[model samples]
Every structure is written in C-alpha cells, then in structure tokens.
Target: MNGKPAVFLDRDGVINEDRGYVHRWEDFSFLPGAIDALRQLQQKGYLLVVITNQSAVARGLCTEADVLALHERMCAFLRERGIELAGIYHCPHHPQGSVSDYAIACACRKPEPGMILRAAQAHGIDLSRSLLVGDKISDLEAGRAAGIPSLYLVVPPGQDEDLSSLPGVQRVSGLSEVVERMFGSQAMPSS
Candidate 1:
C-alpha cells in the first residue's frame, strides 16, 4: 500500500477522561470539545489511529474482550459523529501483572514505539509525515522514536502540570488547541 500520513492518538487521558482504566462503556465520557476536535481532525483527511496501554487487563481489572467491546462502541459512536478511525491498538501486557497470560514484558507498550511502528507498517503510514498527540511524556518519546515529525503533549483539563520548555515538543491544554493550530479556522465539521 502507498504510504499516507496518520495521526497517532492516545486513548486514556487524551480521548476519554483518565478515570482509571475504563473498560466499561457507561464510564467512558468524552472530554469537553473532544468530539469537535476529532471532527476537525477527521475533516482534515488524517488517518486517525488510537494507541493505548491497557495494563488493566494484565492487572485483572478487565479482560481483552472487554477492551475490544469498548473500542467497538467507541468506533460506532465516532461513526455517528461522521468520523472514522483508521485503527485502535492497545498494549495489554504489564511487566508486573498478576495475570499470568499478560504478565510478560512486551514491545507494544508506550515509550517503546512498537505499536506505532506496527501500525505504520500495517496501514502504510508515512512516519516522517505523521503526527502523534498524547497526554504523557512517554507518548512524546514513542512518537520521537517512531520518527513522527509532529508531536504534541496534551495536558489533561484543569491539571496543574508544568513541563519545562523542551525542544521539538509543544504542550497543549487539550485536544482543541492542537486542532486549532493544525487546521486553523478551517476543517471543523458541524457536530
């Protein structure tokens, strides 16, 4: 497949409230302006993919099937909003997990860039031209390791997090700020 630019996103904290390992649909709440921001990005013709670390599965908080179910619902909801996701990838392994099946250290986990690398190969995404927006420093490191050109660190709403000015890293209060800068006053689709 010919290569195309894609936007790699982190699920927790960035997309939904980081309310501690959301495995249920009822507890999943979209952050304020998240849907609108997503719509704007969708309109901009970017291949949107979700990359997340779900060690809850390894910690026995939930099952892999539960995560898949939640993602199915998420994609359906996005479709209702006229947005399409290229893919949703999660790392279920934890180094110190209680569950034996998912306890081993894996490469897909954040700060490793394994998931991004796999997604790029699977979807033919041009890593050099792609972008990653996540809420943690690990996310930035993963994007950097994957060679994504644009990386934005999103701070959760109302968080008093202070990050030292880092070269090649832009800090954002939320997803809306990134959307505003990337698309300016254009590409926002009516919700």
Candidate 2:
C-alpha cells in the first residue's frame, strides 16, 4: 500500500478522562465529543491510530490482558459510532516499574517515538502528512521524533500548564476544538 495520512491519538486525557490508571471498562469514559471528532477525521480519509503509554501494566496496577480488554471495549464502543481505529499501540514498560518483566527502559515508551514509528511502518502511514493529538509534552515529543508534521496538545479541564515555550505545538481545549482547528469554524455534528 502507498503511504497514507493518519491522526495519531493519545488514549488518556485526549480520548478519555485520565482518571489515573483506568483499567476497568467501567472507569473509562470518553471525553465529550471525542467520537465525533474522530469520525470527522476518518471521513476525511485519515487513518485513526492510538499511541498510548499504559505504564499501569508495568507498575503492577493492571495486567497487559486488562489493558487489552479495555482497548477491545473502547474499540467496540467507537465501532458502534462508525469510527474505526486503524491500530492501537501501547507501551507497557517503565524504567522504575515494579513488575520484573516490565521494569526496564523501552523504546516504545512515549518521548521515544517507537510506537509511532512502528505504527507508521505497520500501516504504511506518511509521517510527514500525519498529525498527532496528545495531552502531554512527552506525547508531542514522540510525534516530533517520528516526523509527524502537526502536533496538537489537548489541555484538559482543571489542569493548566504553561505551554507557551513549546514551539510548533498547537494548544486546544478538547477534541471539539481540534476538529474546529482542522476543519475551520464550521461546527461538526456529533454521532
């Protein structure tokens, strides 16, 4: 397949509420308008891929199976809304993790770009034509390292960090604002 443009999304905060270490499906809640925003991007022919850091697995708060189960449920939920994700890549490793198997510095972790790089290669994505939306600086760093041209930082409610220092990164309130920035002032209908 010839390369195609994609939108790399961060799971927590950007896709759902970052309710610390959310492993159970019950705890997972999609941020308002996330589904619609993703659907709009999909309709525009951009592959939707999720690149996330599931360090809870490494910290022993949850197992890899648990994370996979949550992802399955999340994907099913999106599928019901006509939004299909091309791929979901997660890093279950951390340097100071308690789980012996996962307690090591890994390339796939955010700020490293391994997951984004793998997704690009796996899906034949054109990094130069793709965009990334994430809530953390590490997420943008990974996107930059992987050569994504556009980087959007979603600042969730109740948290405010001075991001004026980061050049080339666009700050957005949420997925709704992201869609607005991408498609202009016209409003998108929710699914």
Expressed as tens digits, the lDDT of each residue in 1-191 for candidate 1 is: 35988989999888889899999999999988888888778777779999999999999999999999999999999999888999999999999999999998888999899999999999889898788999988888889888987989887557654446346787787788888878776746555
Report residue 154 deviation for candidate 2 (angstroms).
0.7
Best by TM-score: 2
What are the clashing pairs of model 1?
A: none
Model 2 worst lDDT window (10 residues): 182-191
Residue 55 in model 1: lDDT = 95
TM-score of each: 0.93, 0.95
Q: Clashing residue pairs in candidate 2, if any?
A: none
Model 1 global lDDT (CA atoms, 0 to 1)? 0.88
User: What is the alpha-carbon RMSD of candidate 1 to the true structure?
Assistant: 1.8
C-alpha lDDT (0 to 100) for residue 40 of candidate 1: 79
Local lDDT at 100 for model 2: 95
- What does candidate 1 score on TM? 0.93
